[model samples]
Target: VIDIFNNFALGICEGQQLDMDFESKTSVSREEYLRMIELKTSVLLKGALQIGAVLGGANEKDIENIGEFGRCLGLAFQLQDDLLDTYGNVDVFGKNIGGDIVAGKKTILTIETISLLGLKAEIFVELLQNKTLSRYTKVNDVIKIYDQVGVKQIAEALIEEYFKRAYDSLMKISVPDERKVVLIEIAQNLMNRQN
Candidate 1:
């Protein structure tokens, strides 16, 4: 328990540090972004499930499976969050859209767009970094660039991949099939959510 807590705290701190470090850079690779999110977001979910399984007297294998499930789910959730921040309906999502772009956050969409656009990515980055532009205008400009590069499709595919991984992990758990149904439903709902 102590070790889990210690590692969890360390992971969160490391993730935060990486996020801060990435902010100063013009671009971050997909691998670096994934590692950061795994530490910042997924570690908390992984630690929670592992600790719960321990308290519930789960065997080692079950613990491992549940932890995998948590990690994959966390990744999928963050991907969805990135999507929602850009494309979700403001009313349904209950937040301002394109907040990520306005803040110049480096998400899968941004990273992929950067890679795909080659030299053209500079224009998009410039729009994101321009403080003089209105938030609405900046978001619209960025979205236009993303649309041209098919970033939405790419990001959706990646999100689905993570979702499938989460499901596969859940299936490996030793629990009864019925016991897993609720979790499956929850994952589906999260994936389908507009907010």
Candidate 2:
């Protein structure tokens, strides 16, 4: 149990620090951000799937294949989480929407768009820090930033990367397509999900 916790801890810490560094306007290259995401989130999901497949009597090849599939889905899942934290309903989610924005946690969309948006980034960053600003104003300011930096488009592209990897992994599994199709459908549905 300790090892399991330890294995997970490293990635979780990396993810948290990555978000903090990104959001606080600290320096982070795009490569550094992706590396952090893959380590913190996707690695755990991949491990779980691999261990389950092995314990269930799957061959090494099959386990490896499923692990890759899980990795792709996990990446997409984390990215969707970032999107939701920005755009989803707070009441239903049971957390403050755009907490990430206020915290300045660097996500893929945020990191990617900052350079593209130029001076507007500075304005939005300031607005995010203005304690007197209303929630409505704060949200609108973020939306404007999103529009300027093309966050929506960037999200779509990142999700597409996950989907493509997932597809290839599904195709690699030696199991019947009928048995594997369910997982593929799950991946597809996750990619399209809004909440």
Question: What is candidate 1's lDDT per residue for 110-172, written digit by digit as tens?
Answer: 999999989887877877789999988989989988899899998899889988998998899
* lDDT, candidate 2, 57-97, per-residue tens: 88889878888887788887888888778877776656777
Clashing pairs counted in every model: 0, 2
Scored by lDDT, the top model is 1
Q: Each candidate: what lDDT?
A: 0.90, 0.74
For all predicted structures, in order, the TM-scores are 0.95, 0.80
| Model 2, residue 123: C-alpha shift (Å) | 4.0
For candidate 2, what is the TM-score? 0.80
Model 2 off-target regions past 4 Å?
Answer: 1-9, 20-25, 89-96, 118-121
Q: Cα lDDT for residue 42, model 1? A: 89
Candidate 2 — worst ten consecutive residues by lDDT sum? 1-10
